[model samples]
Target: MSRRRRKALPSEPVRCVIETLSHDGRGIARDNGKAQFVDGALPGETVMAKFTSTRSKFDELRAVEVLEADDARMTPPCDFADLCGGCSLQHMSGESQIRFKEDTLREHFAHFGGIEPDEWVAPMRSPALGYRRKARLGVKYVPARESVLVGFREKRNSFLTDIDRCVVLDPRIGDRITPLRELLHGMDAYRRIPQVEVACGDDSAAMIFRNMDPLSDSDRQSLIDFGQAHDLHIYLQPKGPDTVHRIWPETGEERLSYDMEEFDLTMKFHPMDFTQVNVDINRNMVHRAVEWLDIQPGERVLDLFCGLGNFTLPLARSAGQVVGVEGDDAMVVRGRENAELNGLSNVAFHGADLQADFTAQPWAAEGFDKILIDPPRSGAQEVCEYLTAFGAKRIVYVSCNPATLARDAGVMVRNGYRLVRAGVMDMFPHTTHVESMAMFERVDN
Candidate 1:
């Protein structure tokens, strides 16, 4: 039998009443009893949307025109806000954006975890603009435009956005996007250079160029000149992350350090190492985590997923002893060095993968009075089973993904923990990406 072809999408825009916002800030509406998700729209607004894709249950749409505006809506600060995927909620007011995140967290907890916190912590805030200190910026040399483009990818698309600069990045680098593009355009390895990882410390910034092919002498000279002009620590990675090496001013320390004055601690890290993007908020977050963890002077604590001892070293300053475990050997080695450098003799570091069966590990057998878990987006499902075995009195989880946190919270509650406090952190201020911290106490004990 001959198969019937699918119907083509409507050429003109269709009007819809936005009911609410989806998880990623898209507007949710109903049309012909099927759900329609409209992008670049707000709640309680009437918009004329164009369908981009369709599924069996819902249709994806892009709002081309707004027939009615919402109270929470505002003008976006970035010129490339509409096309850049770097930020999603830039159109909403900063205050409302944070409020939305709080609501989302509450919703996720209620829907997935089936419980709520006894106390809701206030949202942490800092300078929203130019707060990001690290990012992997994409590079593209479009022959059609006869120019190089560098920045984030296009919204809801894989293509790169034609942006001059980024407002979310630190002004030291955000304002230099076009200059970076120009510099790359003048190089012979521009096409081979797929990405530039930007990392900054308190006093310095570094850029690592991921080169697929070797750079010529002229290309190296041009990069040196660019580095001098911008005062940037330039490095080149010919292969994987391990092959990254300093190119310009190839001498002194190539490390970036951030200070947590409250804890009287300094964390030295490589540019390629994973560090929190917002420096001010990170320092504040560490302080909050330390306060919320409630580490006693004589208590033993376990720091899981401790990267470069960001939390392990700080937590050690207060606790009698802190044992850190991470999946990366390099990070574990770095953590031990950081502990030694900071003169935190009570802190110890171990390398172990927490995702799999880690019960055989040496630190896994020890009983911890308190615990701090900072797992990735997948959450700490495996470690949840061991909380009771370790006799943990209190637990603090630093989560970047709320859905995972909500799921893990359910696991912890079932294991005799009570959700005491929960709150959202404005790590990526204007973006829908949520970073949250929650505290759980062993109530049944």
Candidate 2:
């Protein structure tokens, strides 16, 4: 038997009117009762789309020309927005982007959780451009072009986009992409380098190069010179993550820090550690979470999925004691280190598998007055099952994914809590990724 060959895409462009937006920022249209997802198109727009792939249930296409534009549509700021996969909703205005995210969250709650909050808070907004502080850029050397490409992958493809600069990235690193390409092209290990991870803090930025082979002295010196000239800390990973070591500034601490002026605190972390990509939005998020929790001086607060004391230390300033729990022990250690650096002895860090039963643990013996949860994209379904055991009066949940948040919100409602207020956060301005927050209060409390 032979495998069936895939159907060929239509050679001519098809005209369609976009009815709505998909969760991933694609425009949805119907053609002969079948759905079509068109990239770079907005809802309420008429476009001529070229089919890229065909499927039985639905088809995929890219919008070649917009015949009619939506009121929310705007010209993308990035020159390579159409080619780069890093951002998806750049054509939509920032205000419209926030509205789309809010709508997405509302639909998730209504469909998955079968519920809605009593009140919806205002969406937290951030700078529409130059807000991204963390990114992993692809590096490839093309001999035909006699140059190297350093940027994100092309939309819907594995090939790197031929971009000179990224407007969304922090200008410190985004502005240097062309120079970076030139510098890498001159290196003997240009072909051996696969990617570069960039991270920026308030005062400094760092880049870690993933090198397949050991660099020669000349290549190493070249990297050092680039770092020194650009004021970037450089690290090279020859084999594995554990082998990453800093080469430039060869002396002091191997860390970058961002200041939380609201709490009069500074958060220090390694370049590889997990940190929020948008610093302004993160600061606003932290402030809002703390304010919503309404921590009192005599109360004890519990922070779940805490990483590096982002919320724990801030709560400690108001609460009598704050206990933070995380799955990664390294992050637990980092939390403790941050606590010590802040000179706060009221906060304690613990490492535990949050998905498992930890009710017997000593920390769980005493009930908490308030709770703050900042779970990952997977959400905290298992942890939601045990929230009643802690008997916290108020629970604040910060979520990166709205679907999981809705699912967990239903669990909280079923467990004798009511969804009081929920809202969205514009963390990634040009992406469909929805960052949200909700306030839950015990029915009897």
**CA lDDT of every candidate:** 0.90, 0.94
Give the residue spans of candidate 1 off by over 4 A: 1-7, 357-360
Every candidate's CA RMSD: 1.7, 1.0
Residue-wise lDDT of candidate 1 within 299-338, one digit each (tens)? 9999999999999988998898899999999898889878
Q: List the residue pairs that clash in candidate 2.
A: none
- TM-score of every candidate relative to the true structure: 0.97, 0.98
Off by over 4 Å in 2: 1-3
Ten contiguous residues minimizing lDDT sum, candidate 2: 358-367
**Ten-residue segment with the worst summed lDDT in candidate 1?**
357-366
Relative to the true structure, candidate 2 reaches a TM of 0.98
Total backbone collisions for each predicted model? 0, 0
lDDT of 2 by residue, 311-396 (tens): 99989999998999999998999999999998999998999999998878999788899999999999999999998898899999
